[model samples]
Target: MLNNMLVKKAFRIIRRNYGCPGLDGVSIKDIKQNYNYYINKIIDLYNSYTFGRYPVKTTTITDYNNKPRDIFIYCLYDRWIQQILKLQIEEIIENDLKEYVFGYRRKLNIGMLRKYTKSFNSKYILNIDILGFYNHINRDHLNKVLIKNTSISKEFLTRIDLSFSHLSNGLPQGNVLSPILSNYYLAGIDSMFNSKYARFSDDMFFAINDLEEQNDIINKLVPELGKLSLSINFEKVRLFETNSFK
Candidate 1:
């Protein structure tokens, strides 16, 4: 059943888009063996540039010999982020381990878009517009604040309770860190898999060289997120081996 879902062009497009200098020699079977080294190097590069002040884009360039440097630095930062993603794909190819899968529950689902984009043969395809969605929710939160502030204190208390009741189901208030933490985990999966090959919304795929490593990731993630009320549906979890193993 899953075999029919495979879009052969997805791999071709990924190779075309992210196939870079260091990616030249990697293969699908050796990804895991090389992932840690690549990720460490990426972390080193990010830490080096991201220290002191966050990279920003504006008409400010008093640093680096007084030449306009902020925009160039910002672009460079983005380039490194992209290169790190490419290396992750190479890592996936080099490793031969059991495949891991995850099922996600979220307010929105983009399963159809995932299907459609895969069918379209695009180089970089992501169904959900995560950035746009975040902006929309933040605007809504701002509106709620305006409504609360414009009202009388007694009525404001009642409206605040009602507003928060609705907001919790959307994105929890006073939790800007929640979004960062969620993105961190999501990004970590991409780093782990070294591929946009990981599915969104309903599923995630992890291919590791060792079965034990796969279990280790699950153990780490489950406890890390346990206090946050994040959950997993174990019934949907399945184990499969490539036909090459048999």
Candidate 2:
């Protein structure tokens, strides 16, 4: 059951933040003006186990490189739902996630990656990029992974499936919950390798001593990724030796 206090907190946070209205044209002001009505509506939807789909609007923003990057905006109500789901999912999977996952979390970045690598005395690094990672995530595969990682009720699973079914091909970027979902989806890959590895979103770094170990990891990973409709970007694969260790 969704906690009322958490729901209220989620609503309060979204109401204060400035964002463009979603497909339904429900602005933050509108939601605030009719806060009670909106709250009732959200509760009713939750009770009925039906979440209405929201249309995505695309807009471009300049990235750190000063290049335009496209971002998807979903309905405010949908965003609120995402917030709730994110909290729930995080609580469920937080303890189970591998330390190698550093994306979307604070104080876990390149420095931590460096420390992990040095501790393992890794001489060679294999950096891998998954081609079209979010677009290629198979829904069925994700469902199985979710079920395996946590205990969820059938009703909750149905609602989750309905939410994802609206996405069709794969998870969308710019959603609060997407990063966590992507991390969990790739957890299987992390579990398969004993070699030192770390991931930040779709980019993965594997530390090994020789080409043989690299090949061994790749050969095993490719087929596993294939099952989830994900593939490696052969063109982006780079192997480099650590000068100090080399």
Candidate 3:
């Protein structure tokens, strides 16, 4: 599925969006210097169906809380490859997900989220964030969800599976493929909460009948999320009156 034409387009998209070189500090211009070479390398990696152990630059940044957070960076070619994979799978996964899942989906935004949540017409709205979402997703569960929900080729699946060899958990935050995989895994939450639910990435919103039902959902979410090795960020959790949202 990693072909020359698609890879070339992926390269152009990367160049247009790029701000800096990655991992090895290799710029998109540097990649264009021997574009075919990088393309060949990515295509061969696909044929081999093995994780290339591609390099990612690691750096720390201060988050809103003034705490340090480490983010991963991938080289231009790796980003190209990831973009191709994302192009292949995101639509399929997005279609499988509910309309309320607003994150990383095309043609979706806070406006759409608001419209959908309002449709529930319930008495309250609960907003809760998952703790360390991108960094805490279990790799094994991610693999399972991706395979179950996507129809990618065996070779493509192997390339993803092989990637798990480098790390035991978490989707690296920077790559395009990370969103596709992460969104699909969180589909469990979408399924578990059938209606009156909206999720924009890790932030989940639920429309509730009252306090009793809200507590019951929260109580249930703890263990269900625990099954995925994830937990709620209680400090950030908020319950709002329906009109407050309106």
Candidate 4:
């Protein structure tokens, strides 16, 4: 019914504009034979309705109010990474430590503190994934890991490994054991800092002295990220030096 209505409208326009049976220097016979032109016009209109919009607005970490990215990150941290970190911290406290033997000399205390710190460090990779959280398959008792139908190619994944030197280089994204590769690149920034920091997706705010270090890390990581089939925006990276942070 809709097709008929559209065809009728097209014919009406052709007839009204060229009642004498010739239009745009073509005869009525030629106009009638121009089926391809009319068909193409209709297909173009259909495409405008389909490819022009999506139900979920897709965006990146830097973009705000884009529901998909926002929801994904929120689910990642609040539901997954946070809990994992809590458990890991508990494990580190429980399994990796021995009773302190401290009531002795200054040199002995310093050496013991260093040994404990290094032991904890050995149990952890110096990196984290920014979007380390994985959603569950469903809100059910089975508790399967959530999967995204990512289009990343196998070749791209291989190249990302090569780029990060098998995750031995670059800053961490957030969760060390998180499956997402992007996290390692982002989380390693803390390696340069002498204190803690916070992050909002890719937007990072850190100590001034550490800003150059962060920039250098990001700069180095950006080129290698093409291995993962990802790109970074240099223009949007903001560097601020402030005395406000305690």
Candidate 5:
């Protein structure tokens, strides 16, 4: 159950951050003006175990190359709820996550991956990236992962299901909690492979000694990923020999 203290802490985090309005156009200023009322409302919904819907606003921003890119904005209230859940969920699964995963973890980045690569004496590296990673995550697979990894309540599971049902397919991109969820969802892949593997978001690197081993790993991995409704972007898949690494 979400308590007042947790709600308040979540509110503080949301209040400190600057964010655009949701599809409903409820601005941060508006939320600040009626902070207590909104917070209480959110608590009431959470306490009652009711699932609430939030709008996702889509807007285009001009890139440095003068290209327009669409960015989705989630509601502040929704973000506050996510913040609370993220804290609890991460606390439960953080230690269980593999060391190879560097995405979304504190103080872990490409540098760690580089150092890890240096330990590998393999001359062949297989690089794979999942296309539309966030948009392609299987909801059923994610639910199973949460269930297996945590002891969340049935009511809480219902609430989670209700929340995700709004997203027809894949996890929502740009949400604070999505990356953590993505990492957890892919944990199975990490456990299945014995090779020197590293991941940053959906980008995966595998160190193998030869082409035969690379093919063997691919054969084992493809079906596993398929069970979760994930696939590699073959066009982006690269296998190259690096004599310098050996």
Candidate 6:
């Protein structure tokens, strides 16, 4: 699925989004100036079966909560490769993701999420946010998940791993591939709950018909997530006994 045509498509994606300059300070305009050379360079790297790490640029900004959030940016070629990988990997796994796993996907949105939550109409809504989800991704288990899917090419999987070789753990927060990869990794949560929940990225939530099941759920999740080297951010976890989904 990844080819020269797909590489060109990735370029189109980067340009359409007006991708930001990374730590190297190379912009889309810079690439457009000598577009063919850069395009061939990307092709050459792939043709040689090599994927190299680029310095990630990070800037801290105040999120909506007024808390500092670090946004990561990769070099131009790196972004292109990531976009290419995203497009291919999405084809392999997108349709297979759980119905309530709403995050970073083109087809699902907040309206559908609200409707799903409303359909529950349970007595309690438990909101559980994984702490620094992107930062804490278990690469080994993630690799396992991707590897188990026999349809994905080994070369493709190798390139994806090389893209993140610099990080001992965690996926880069700003990379194009991170969102979908995170979704794939956390699909275990949906399986754990038998899809009785709504998750927007790592913002995990569950609607409970009985308050008694609340503690049981949390207690079970604690150890289950640990199997993947993950832990709940207790500070961000909360339980609401509500009459309605709102």
State residue 32's C-alpha deviation in candidate 6, in Å.
2.3
TM-score of 1: 0.26
Between candidates 2 and 4, the TM-score winner = 2
Using Cα atoms with residue i matched to residue i, what is each candidate's TM-score against the true structure?
0.26, 0.84, 0.85, 0.24, 0.84, 0.90
Q: Each model's C-alpha lDDT?
A: 0.34, 0.74, 0.75, 0.32, 0.74, 0.78
lDDT, residue 221, candidate 6? 88
Worst 10 residues of 2 by lDDT: 63-72
Q: In each prediction, how many residue pairs overlap at the backbone (N, C-alpha, C within less than 3 A)?
A: 14, 0, 0, 19, 0, 0
Q: Write the per-residue lDDT of candidate 2 for residues 50-159, one digit (tens) a residue.
A: 67476777787874324345566778777787677766677677666788877766567766765676676678888888887877888777777787754655666666
* 5 against 6, candidate with superior TM-score: 6
State candidate 4's TM-score: 0.24
> How big is the positional error of residue 170 in model 2, measured in Å on the Cα after superposition?
1.0
lDDT (Cα, tens digit) per residue for candidate 4, span 71-162 = 21121111122222223233322232223322111243433433433333222212212222223111111111111213433333332332
Candidate 2: list runs displaced more than 4 Å: 12-20, 60-70, 243-246
lDDT of 1 by residue, 1-246 (tens): 111112223233333543222312444334346644544543553434331122332343452113222212122223334333333332332232212212122232344324433443433322111222222233243334334433223332232233223233333312212232233234333445443244442244333445575576567556533433344446455443422211
Local error of candidate 4 at residue 134 (angstroms): 12
TM-score winner, 2 or 6: 6
> Per-residue alpha-carbon lDDT of model 5 for 32-116, expressed as tens digits?
7987897788787777756337767677777332434455667776676777777767766677788888888988987677568
lDDT of 2 at 79: 77
lDDT, model 2, position 90: 75
**Model 5 bad stretches (over 4 Å):** 59-71, 240-246
Cα TM-score of candidate 5: 0.84
